[model samples]
Target: MSVPENQQEAKNKKKRKFEMPDTYVILFIVLLIAVAATYIVPAGTFERELVDEVERVVPNTYAQTDSNPTGFMDIFLALQEGMVQSGGLIFLVLFAGGAFEVVERSGAIKGGILRAVNKTKGKEFLLIALVSILFALGGAVGAVANSIIPFVAIGVIIARALKLDAIVAVAITFGATFAGFNVGFLNPYTVGIAQSIADVPLFSGMGLRVIAFVVIVGVTILYTWSYAKKVLADPSRSLIGVLDEGKEGESPLDAPFTGRHKLILSFVGLCLAFFVYATIEFQWTIDHMAAFFIIIGIGAGIIAGMDYNKLTLTFLEGCKNLVYGALIIGVARAILIVMENALILDTFVQALSVPLEGLTPVFAALGMFVANGALNFLVPSGSGQAMIVMPILTPLSDMIGVTRQVAVQAYQFGDGFTNSIFPTSGPLMASLAVAGVPWIKWAKWMLPLLLMWTVIAVIMLTIGVLINWGPI
Candidate 1:
């Protein structure tokens, strides 16, 4: 006969298993409503008309040279510029994604990751730090999703083989990497877009961004380790076991690391050498050198025996991965058009300063952060958001007594934070969908990290105030 207490425990287990996280479908509904409202409201009408005007203000490449351009021609100019921006963004995504695919496919990435990880797997503290730096590097390249996702899966597979619960696999590998994305160094989209919008330099927040990256990564490592420990201590609570109960340690899967892999990896190394040499030796932008990496990556992948057909296939797949982001980029442009239409983009800057003119620098930073956050929801596209918001923020910085650089950092915090947990972004959703981790689950994992991060960020901003570190 089953004991009464034991029977109660079973009942509880059944109930708990049936209980699900309540995802706010309302939030999703609200987003749809907002997008719809954009077409109905007078605010939107002004924006639309404003966009029409800007369309006239900007010139087509050919039409721009004519000093006596008509209003119709001006609209043509705006449209032409918009098309160029749209195409450049697509090309940038292609290059970024293609380069990552080529480099990782060349075999150096897995080998490097495996070798480095294997050395520290058993060492908890060391393992945590390594994963943080690993993803942070991935973030810098805008390949956190494409590359980090698989790398983490490999960790999960390896962990299962070793009888470790898979939470370590998901939480440590993907989670840590996502955290890095939250505070990446000069990302093409996140910081790059925000900086561009605010008219701040492309990498204006380098010093603070690095500091934020490290601070957040350190916090995530600690949390991931704790969560992993819980899974290890009580296997029932561990999701990793459910993910791959029968798998074994890296047992030579079908994917073989080849000499071609080594050769490709070597090219990556050479590219790095050139980057270092160029940056220190010639002062090239560390941020723009990503193209060189992509070029080397393609050459190496081909040399390493990635079939020409397969290489192209993989390259296209890379593009496919970012296809949604690319589309979102276009949709985001529509919103930018709306903003430029209203002529309110700069008005936001005047609004921000008028209220907080006398507040401490820390408060001013906080105010900008909030504005950037609100801006993110409407202009979810990174580059689009920047182009919409920055022109105004950049010119008004002097009046607000806040430096353009500080405004840029605020935009970064806003841009980076929302991307981690926002529903509007396809990349985050895509990654979660691929991993079978739901959006609610991501928010659950991320909230604590983001909460702790915000506190740390404010502290840093305050310190900047004390030291007068910002550009103003």
Candidate 2:
């Protein structure tokens, strides 16, 4: 009854189609469910735990909130009220960063950064470390994401063309910058705000922050290199896309090096040296970070031979990209309206903050991760998130016999990791959208890298807590 081997038959072969991860679909569903549940649960508004902090912040800015009944409509309602103003932050940072992107694309800054990343002058690893330190210094002085994000994209593009993984760009920019952001040594935003709330000296934790920066930079390089290898092997596995960076009708390496590039680099170097010396020595604050980048744009624009009018126009164009992300985050902020209505955020915290009555160092770190992730939704702003969570968390850690520094480390991991992938959070989503990558697509690449980081963070957390890294 069987057909002879060669003569009998040919069958159609089936091929597997590419599928988006189930997790991607789940993110949207979760958003919808959160929206619907907020409506079904009748409620009151969330109390501003950081209200005192906010009062001192913008000094009676109209952005203050009050509790209210919740509904599915509340998410949109929050956006309608303009409750999320991060769009402005995004706009500013991205504009400056974007301008740098175009400038680099024009071949003015790319060579300088590459020169920074890989140099014939010193050890290669040390040069990579130096690139990270400079970026972190940018953050320490209060350069926000608007600037950081575009810098990230431009750096990614350059890295890809240079055969380095874009993950290195991401890890260095986000991790080093956030680590510096957390340090608040002279950080324009959170460090000052947090110090005031903690009633600690403005630079009380300065040394620790510097250490954190080094630690995180090391982690970033380690993770980035590891992740980049897999992608280099099989491009599909990369979270950061390899872009066709050769802009339309333009050559990729048209004058990759020019005197204009060196001049801009010299101007930037002079300005950075002046800024850093002033910050550490004279303790100056002319909003120097923003001012510095602005100067870089003007100087780079000129070096690239862009006219003043074209420079100004391109600057504005770059800023436009950030608004998209800011608006998306504004949309995500609707959850706060829901949580406030449900009276759930505090309840959630109550369960978490209590009965840890006694936890070992490792368990305490684990608890911090869980609590930080959940609490992040309610107080999503990192500055605000830390103010609300850290105070309670720091005290709770004492009860568990863990150091506040360990508490801080735990907070960092929680704050830093999820932003890269969470759709409920806007900046990451917006960044992905701008790059023409979707959340689902990003998650595929990030999943493996995130797991690596998670394992590393846990290990680091134990080291912090067990070694008792902080003062008693």
Candidate 3:
């Protein structure tokens, strides 16, 4: 081969070697690894105590029990159980999909978004920053992540209309929410549940969390806006490629915005406001949110002047579009199920904590951050992870002279930020599917931002430890 040809061949070989496996395949491999660990790592359990009507771990109560390595049949059964367990989340995705579809078909969503885009014509950066912060605030309040799923498709459409890529859409929607969630400014899922388990007053360390929230969100806006400018400058630079396929073809704004579109969009805005309010006041679950979306869809269809029959069909079509993304939730849940059934969840936590035994308080807090990130891959649910991990960590933090608040901070940071990159995360996968972007592309795009978030996390954690962030 000629020298240049040899170099080209070598590049192709390297690319092939680093290629990402299919998401399903990667998940299955992870399940197998979890199964193997069950046999290698000793099975264990932590005694539980009822704190504030919730089950929490009794610190230092971990005791090894008999090994329960899952057999092939057991793995299959676990997968089945996982799907059943994830029924609420799966249904939420479907309902939200159907609901958003109804709105889309009615043309209200696209029209309003396009009108807004046109209004911001010369200041697209302002649009990205404002929308991201709005989503981030919603996430900061909690129960907004699942609610935001229906809006994922809407976000992608808007990004394309604004001359950006699929990555920007996911970043502004899921990524922004996650950053707010990770910083944990009043996020009930992570901070509430975690602090409850740790026996700290609920939201006791709000001052620190507020500072962290601003820093994280500001960095994220700059990161996403910078990438968006690159893609706009050279359309070929877009990771999603030309997004013309499978869309409504002509610009949605080509049709003039009408009074009907205004009313419909206003109704949706009111529904979203209620969603946030009721979620905080009533502590609404996924099922409640799902039902709310269904109601919104029906109302939107009626207001947009769709006949009953047409509305029904459009709603069904929306659900059909989301089937792939919904199934990703069920399949991902199986990873947790297999680990839970094999009784390795607690064992892994115990093993990961062993190294922190002799470390200084500052290092121990940092170690907790690292361990929580590792644990996040196997257990991605924020509240679920908090319930399982916090009890053990609270006591560990005390022994190392790290405040319980810092431990909760570490836990939230670990559980929140990694979701954006982990294949096991249902929301991340679903959002990517909605945008037609591959996990590998999203992960590669997210690496720098993730590293920056980690640095922010470590720095905040260190400061918390030094300040003796305590409300114990």
Show where candidate 3 strays beyond 4 Å: 1-19, 122-215, 221-255, 357-452, 458-472
TM-score of 3: 0.63
Q: List TM-scores for all candidates, in order.
A: 0.71, 0.53, 0.63
After superposition, candidate 2 runs with Cα above 4 Å error: 1-68, 82-88, 102-106, 116-206, 219-305, 341-344, 355-366, 370-411, 415-472
lDDT of 1 by residue, 239-294 (tens): 42445565345363235555666666667657755664565456544245546545
Model 2, range 1-472, lDDT digits (tens) per residue? 8766554434312244554333224333444565565445443222333432331111112222333445556555655543343333334345455555546555554465556654522343454466666666666655444356555665555444545555555555554555454343454334443333333333344565566556655666665556656665677776655554455564332235667777776765576557656655665443445555677677768777888788887766755754443343334433444454555443333445456645666897778876776655443455545544554564455446676666665765676566555655555554554445656756776677666567766776777776775521
Pairs of residues clashing in candidate 3: none
Per-residue lDDT of 1-472 in model 3, one digit per residue for the tens? 4579889999888888554455457567777887788778888887876756545556577898887788989888877886797676667667777877786677665465556666766788988887787678767755356556766776776677776778898888888888888876655546765775577765567778989999999999999988898888998988777455336565544545789888887887788667656755676655676788799889999998999899999888877876765665556667667767777777766665567766888899988888899977876767656655675687566546788899999999998888889988888889899888899999999999999999999899999988898753
- C-alpha local distance difference test of each model: 0.58, 0.53, 0.76
Instruction: Predict model 2's lDDT versus the native.
Output: 0.53
* Per-residue error (Å), model 2, residue 250: 17
Candidate 3 — what's its lDDT? Answer: 0.76
For this target, which candidate reaches the highest lDDT against the unseen true structure? 3
Off by over 4 Å in 1: 1-80, 86-89, 146-148, 162-166, 197-201, 236-244, 247-294, 302-317, 337-344, 374-381, 423-425, 429-442, 465-472
